[model samples]
Target: MAEQLALRGDEKLLDLGCGNGFIIEELLPHMPAGSFVGLDVAPGILQSARKRLDGADIQAEWVEGSADELGRFQDSSFDRAIALYMMHYVDDIDQALAEAARVLRPGGLFILGTDHPDSLGEMHEVHFKALRQMNDVPSALFKSSPKNRISLTNGQEQLQRHFRNVRTHAWKDELLFPSTGAFLDFYQSHNHCSASSIPGLDLGEGFFEELRCRVGHQVNQIITQKGHFKVTKHTGLIICD
Candidate 1:
């Protein structure tokens, strides 16, 4: 995606939903003479990002704000913008796009990465069953969370409304888990939904431990037959001018 942006050495860039600065670290080498601004709503996450870039010898700024409100920056302030794996959480899609268009220079590139709604079909099935067994089904757990506003089917149309020459590319990958416990750990870390996030799911001291036991048994049964379980990730990138 850094290559797709075709960033020059001296351009200023804004990364919306720049969570922990991992992407900034990766893109810094591509833009050695460039300055970067990382914006995210979470202060703790922004602090972690600061630690990541503390000694990187790069010109970077971190800001705590919403993606839909780029008013802090002047019009046409940035040369390019990126919203990777995070636009799904924006509350207002039109407003966020307007903000991106407002702050970016004319002809500036905006790259948006979001998940396909149908992605992780198998993982969701397993999670849904486990929740049902525990009688802890929250509709948001099955449906995408309230913040998720974009999907593969509508991504192109959404971007075309505000940007020219919008195009999309699909990225797919698979992850293999040696055991149910290992897979559970990965899920807890990477997925937006987890035991702690389920609304109204009362927690006792042994809640997750017991839930893991049940889900683990089921997962182990599958592993016993198949040797390992795989989770597929489906993501799409929208590149616009």
Candidate 2:
């Protein structure tokens, strides 16, 4: 939303938790002369991000650090800041928002986009059962955890407490696979509910084969809906002053 919210031609923009530098790459055309900085905690992810935009030819900087504590920048140094899929992982939401406000100029805007609490249950439809079955464990193993949707209510409240204005929006989308087996395989690489985030997520040996069989049996009953599965999402904007 930085481009939509009037990120100027000369303003310095900061992207918090900018996974793989995707936004910086996409915003290159609009910010040919503007400075873009991407911040994330994962060093490996940042390395891959550098490769993603290797030949973009636009000026940008990628740093491995916490957005909640911009170690290198002075107060009120940035013209705009955006936090995408970030607040949930932060230990201190208010402090993060305060840091955003600290780095942003008085009139500058700080935007935040995070997964809605409602999306947590919906995401499970695609991968949770397999997450349990793959390990040959009981369903109760990980029935209660906030991997994809943590800090549901507190996050929103904290944003409101820190930002001057708050606005909301809702969205939903579907993930398609050729078959249920295809989906199980994809989850190996793409599942958001990792073991560390979810308690008792121990899928023992022969995970792939077992998960595939279970998913196929259930998927065959519902073919009219096509190969895709729907995912509901909600997001809001915290306009920092």
Candidate 3:
């Protein structure tokens, strides 16, 4: 967004669907006083965001709302808007794009950062492999965006349909771990109480222990064969007017 907007300290910026307000923290420092705002539906995440500031007088607004549907705010109220890692969850991509356009000034830009649509393809391959081991065939949840969900391919069109000069810039990174232990913390970053490798299911102590044993056995075989397993993750950006 900083690249697309060429942001300055005085610009009024909005972080749409600013989950956990991580971007807000990074942005607030560079922005001029009283120039930044954040919008998200998750109030708890917003509250956690407040704690990140340590009660320092912040020059930003936090709105508990959905970017997919901006209820208030007059047209052309902001200089720049950001939709980061969020377009994949909206219910109405077109409506969200229009609403975002509605809140942005004539020359303003809406920068979107999302999971690469193809990321799902890669995930499906890995997840289905794991599921098959557990004898659980993949379903709609793994195929497409489920109920109350969205996708990057559709999101690209939605942005172009409502705004002029829409351009997508790709940003990708492949995550590789030498050992599962390197990514266990990354995996734990999921929403609390959300299980991993086992879904709609629980792997009790014995279950995890057996998994550890089995995986360990596999790792030993790899060591003997001089091989390592690699996992990959990808993300990208879409800039629109």
Each prediction's number of clashing residue pairs? 0, 2, 0
TM-score of 3: 0.78
Off-target runs (Cα >4 Å) in candidate 3 are 120-124, 135-141, 145-154, 188-229
| Each model's lDDT | 0.81, 0.66, 0.63
Please provide TM-scores, in order, for all candidate models, with all chains considered together.
0.91, 0.78, 0.78
TM-score, ranked from best to worst: 1, 2, 3
Candidate 3 overall lDDT versus native = 0.63
RMSD of each: 2.1, 3.6, 4.2
Weakest ten-residue segment in model 2 by summed lDDT: 144-153
Ranking by lDDT: 1, 2, 3
Question: Which runs of model 1 end up more than 4 angstroms from their true locations?
Answer: 136-142, 145-148, 191-195, 198-205
Tens-place lDDT per residue, model 2, 1-241, is 6544575577788988888998777777677678878889899998988899888776678988886677588888888888876766766666778888788887888777766555534445645665655544555545544424434344556666766765554355555555655655555554434532344565554654565566555554443466554434455554555
Please list the residue runs of candidate 2 whose C-alpha ends up more than 4 Å from where it truly belongs after superposition.
120-122, 126-154, 175-178, 196-205, 224-228, 235-237
Select the stronger candidate by lDDT from 2 and 3: 2
Q: Write the per-residue lDDT of candidate 3 for residues 9-108, one digit (tens) a residue.
A: 6778888887677787777666756477778888998877767765665776778987777868888999888887766566676788888889999888
Candidate 3: RMSD to truth: 4.2
